[model samples]
Target: MARIGVLLMAYGTPRSLEDVEAYYTHIRGGRPPSPERVAELQERYRRIGGRSPLFEITLRQAQALEARLARLALGHSFRIRVGMKHSPPFIDEAVAGLLEEGIERLVAIALAPHYSRMSVGAYHAAVREALARRSAALPVAEIRGWGSHPLFVIAVAERLKEALEDLPRQETMVIFTAHSLPARLREEGDPYETELLDSARRVARVLGLDHWRFAYQSASATGEPWLGPDLLEVLEAIARQGEARHVVVCPIGFLADHLEILYDLDVEAREAAEGWGLSFRRTRSLNDDPLLIETLMALVSEALAD
Candidate 1:
C-alpha cells in the first residue's frame, strides 16, 4: 500500500523569550519590530507562563491524528508531520522530510479552520514553493478550509455548551471571536470574514443561541482599521446595554491555547469585561480534542478520495 503524508501547518510561536525578536521579524517579512514592540510581546509571553504551548499542543494534535488514522486502517498507511509558517520545522523542511520518507502522496491542512488568502492560502503557497524548490513532483491535495465541517461545528459547540453551563443562558451574552485581519481584504473580495461568520452562525444554531455576536480580536496595531467590532469594544457595548450580566467568549478561530487565548482573551478581554461589571468566561481551546482529530481524519479522507 502506498504511504500518504499528512502535513499539518500552523502559525508558529517562539520557543522562548530569546526567540521572540526573530519570530516577530519573520512574521513582519524580515523587518524587525521596534524594541518597544518586542518588549511588549515578550511581556505578554511572560504573563502567559513564560512561553506559548502552541508548538507542543500542535505536536500532540499531529500525534493524535496519526494514531486515529492508523486505527481507521485505511488502505494506505499514514505519516503525519507538522510545519510552521514563521519558525523552525518550516514548510520546506517538512516537505523535504516527507520526500525523504518516500511518501507516495501528500495532503496539507492549515490548523486554521477558516480560509483567508493571507492565512490558509499562504500555507498552501508555502507547500507549493517547497515542492518547486526541490523540483519534486508529488501528488498533493490541500484543504483550504473546514470551518463548517459538521464535526468541527460539533466540537466548538460542545466547548461552548460546556462553558455556558455555569452562566445564566438568558442573562449571559455569547461572543464568537476570531483573529482580526486587515480590513482591506474585504475590499478585495476575501471570503475570510464570510467564512468566519458562517462558522459562528452554525455553532450558534447548534446551541440555539440567539444572543451571540461575532467579533474580531488580537488585531495588530498597524495604524489601520482591522475587522470589527473588536472583542473588547463588543464587551463595552454589551455592558452599556445592561441586558446581560455575564459574557461567554467562544474563539472559533483558534484551535489551541496560545497567547491569543491565554492573554488576549483570558487576561485582556476578561479584565475589560470585569471593569464594565460583566462577568467573563471563555470556552476552552480544542487542542487535541478527539472530535477535532476526527474532523481532521474526515478532511484527509475526503481529500484523498478526490
Candidate 2:
C-alpha cells in the first residue's frame, strides 16, 4: 500500500519581533518592503494582539481537512500536515512529519483557491526548495487551482444568499473582492486577476445575480501599479449610482479571516461606505465550515484517484 501524504500550505505571518525584518525581506524578494512599511504592517498584527491567527487557523484547517479525509475513507493510508511559507511548523517540518509517518508520496494543496505567482505559486516553490534541502525527490502531486470548483462556486452563492436575505434587494450592487497583485503580473500573462473574475462570474451566475462587479483590495500604492479598480472605488461608484443604500462584498477569493478581511474590508471599506451613506455587509468567511471540509475531501479523493 502506498502511503499518501496530505499537505496544506499558506503564506505565513511572523510570530514575534525577531521574525519581523526577515519575513518582510523574504516577501519583498530580498528588496525589502522598507522598515517603515514593515513597521506599519507589523502594527496591523499588533492591533490584533501582536500575532496573527493565520498559522493557528491553518493548523485547524489541516486538522479539519484530515478528519474529513478519514471520514470520506480515501483508501490510501495518509497523514495530513500544515506548512507555512515563512515560519516554523514550516514546510520542511510538515514534510518531515509525513516521512516519519511513512507517507511515501505527497499531494501538496494550498488553502487558497487561486494561483497567483505571488501566492499559491510561492507555496509550490517552498515545497521544491524543502525537497532540495532534504536531498529527496518525493513523488508529488499538486492541485494547481480550484477557484472554478463547482463546490467552491456553490459555497459563494450560499454565503451571498444568506447576507442578502434581509437587505433591501433593490438595486443593491454586488462586489466580489480578492487581494490584489501588481500590474506587471498580468502583463507577464499571470492569471490572478482572470481567475478571480471567472470565479466571481460563476458564483454570480449560480446566484442568478445580474448586478455584480469585481474589485481588488489590500493593494499597495508603492511606486508600482497594482490591480484595481480598488474596492473602495467600486463601493464609491455604486454609491454614486444613486438609491444604492446597500452593497454586498463577497470575499469569493479568500477561504479564511485574515488581515485583508479584518482591517481591509471590515474597517477601511466600512469607513468608506459610511462616508458615502451606503450600508455595508460582507459575507462571513467559511472558516472550518463542515461543507468546506467536504469539498476538500472530494478534492483529495479526485486527486488520489488519478
Candidate 3:
C-alpha cells in the first residue's frame, strides 16, 4: 500500500516571549511591529503563562490522527506532519519533509473550521506555491472548509451544551464567535462570515438554544474596520439589555487553545463581562479532543477519496 502524506496547517505561535517579534514580523509580511505593539503582545503571552501551547497541541493532534488512521487500516499508510503559518517548521518546510518521505499523494487540512479567503485560502495558496517551487506533481487534495461538517457541528454543540449545564439557559446568552477578518473581504465575496454564522446556527439548533448570538473577536488593530459586532461590544450590549445574567462564549472558528482564546476571550472579555455584573464563561477549546481528532480523520478521508 502506498503511504499518503497529511499536512495539518495552523496559525502558529511563538515559542517564547523572545520569539514574539520574529513571529509578529512573519505575520505582518516581513514588516516588524512597533516596540510598543510587541511589548503588548508579549504581555498577553506573559499573562497566559509565558507562551502559547498551540505548537504542542498541534503535534499531539497529528500524533492522534496518525494513530487513528493506522488502526483503521484504511488501505494506505498515512504520515501526518504539522505546519505553522507564522512560526518555525513552516508550511514550506513541512511540504519539503513530506516530499522527502516519498509519499505517493498529499492531503492538506487547516486546523480552522471556517474558510476565509484571508485564512484557509492563504494556507492552500502556500501549499500550492511550495509544490510549484519543488516541481512536485503528486496528487494533492486540500480540504477547504468543514465548518458545517456533521461531526464538527456535533463536537461544538456538545462543548456548548456542557458549558451551559451550570448556567441557567433561560438567563444565559450563548455567543458564538470567530477571529475577525477585514470587513473588505465581504465586498470581495468572501464567505468567511457566512460560514461562521452557519456553523453557529447549526450548533445552536442542536442545543435548542433560544438566546444565542454570533460575534467576531480578536480583530487586529490595523486601523481598518473588521468584522462586527465585536465580542467585547456584544458583551456590553447584552449586559446593558439587562435580559441575560450570564454569557457563554463558543469560539467555533478556532480548534486549539492559543493567545486569542486565552487572552482575548478569557482575560479581556471576561473582565468586560464581570465589570458589567454578568458572569462570563467560554466553552473549553477543542484541543486534541477525541471528537476533533475524529473530525480531522474524516476530513483526510474525504480529501483522499476526492
Q: What RMSD value applies to candidate 2? A: 2.0
lDDT, residue 113, candidate 3? 92
Mark the 10 consecutive residues where model 2 has the least summed lDDT: 45-54
After superposition on all C-alphas, the RMSD of every candidate to the true structure, in Å, is 0.8, 2.0, 0.7
User: TM-score of model 1 relative to the true fold?
Assistant: 0.99
How many clashes in each structure? 0, 0, 0
lDDT of 3 by residue, 37-144 (tens): 999999999999999999999999999999999988889988899998989889999999999999999999999998887999999999999999999998999888
Residue lDDT tens for model 2, 150-268: 98888878889998988766758788998888889988998888888899989888878887788999997778999888999988887887847889999888888877888788878
Q: Rank the candidates by lDDT, best first.
A: 1, 3, 2
- Clash pairs (backbone) in predicted model 1: none
Candidate 1 contains a number of clashing pairs equal to 0
lDDT of 1 at 197: 91
Cα deviation at 104, candidate 3, in Å, is 1.1
